[model samples]
Target: MKREMIEDALIQPTILLVEPDDKVRPSLMDNLHSWGYTLIVALSETDAMQRVQGKGEPFDLLLMNQVGHSVAELVAIGRDICQHAGLPPSIPVVVMAECYGDDLEGQDVQMGDYEYVAYLEDGQQLKELLYLLCPVP
Candidate 1:
C-alpha cells in the first residue's frame, strides 16, 4: 500500500462584516468576494456576537458599522470574542461609518487609544484598509 501526502489546505482570510445598510451590504459583499475574501455578514451587534462566539470556524477579521455602536463598544466586543470564542487576540477589528469631517479618500482614520481599530468613511477606504489588513500572499 502506498501512502499519499495531504497538501496543506489554503485558508482564505475570513471577515465578519456587521453593516446594517441594505444598500451598502450588497456592494461590500460583492467587492470583498471579488477580492478573494470569505465574508460573513451580520446586521446588528447581537448577530455579530452570535457569529463571533459561534462554534464554527474563526473569522480572521471583523469589520463593523458605527451606526449602532461606538468604536469603543466595538473594540470591547472584539476583546470579548477573543476571550470567549478562542479567536486570536491580534485579529483586526475595523469600524465603518458613512462619513466624517476629516475623512479623506482611501485613508482610514485612527481612533485614539485603539489605533488598530480603523475608522473607515468610504468604500475606497474600506477597500484599501481591508487589503492592507489581509494582504494576499
Candidate 2:
C-alpha cells in the first residue's frame, strides 16, 4: 500500500492527557497532534476528572503526568468516575513521571489497567504505547 493510504487507514486514537507541567504539557500536546491523535488536555486532577465525567465519546486512553497523586490512585479515581458516568473503564491509562520506585516500563508496573512511563521518554515511545493500548480497528 502507498504510504499515505497506510497512514490514512490508521485509526486516530482519542486521548485524555492530564499534565500539570507547563513546559512538558505543550510539547506532549504538539507531539500527539502531529502524530495524528485527537487530544483532550487537562492541567489539573480536578479538570481531568471533570473532563472524563463530562459528556463526549469515550477516550481511547488516558495519558497522565505524575504530579500530586500516584498513578494507581489517579486511575482508580478516574475509572470510578468513568463507571458512574457510563464510560468504559477498561481503556488503558498511562502515567508519565520523572522517576518510579524501580526500573519499570509500560505495563510492567500496571495498576489495574494503568501503566507507568518515564516522562522524559521521546514521543515515539509514547505513540507506541498508545497504539499498544488502543490498536487501530
| lDDT tens digits by residue: candidate 2, 1-137 | 89999886775778878888999888889988877778888787677667656565567777777777765686665566456446665766677765654445333345664544444445567777677776644
Q: What RMSD does each model have against the real structure? A: 3.8, 4.6
Give the clashing pairs for model 1: none
Instruction: For candidate 2, report its TM-score.
Output: 0.73
lDDT of every model, 2 decimals:
0.69, 0.68
Error of 2 at 69 (Å): 1.8
* Poorly placed runs, candidate 1 (over 4 Å): 1-9, 103-106, 111-122
Model 2 CA deviation exceeding 4 Å by range: 1-11, 105-108, 113-121
Q: What is the lDDT of candidate 1?
A: 0.69
Of candidate 2, the 10-residue stretch with the lowest lDDT total is 100-109
User: For residue 21, what is the lDDT in candidate 1?
Assistant: 87
TM-score of each: 0.76, 0.73
lDDT score for residue 84 of model 2: 47
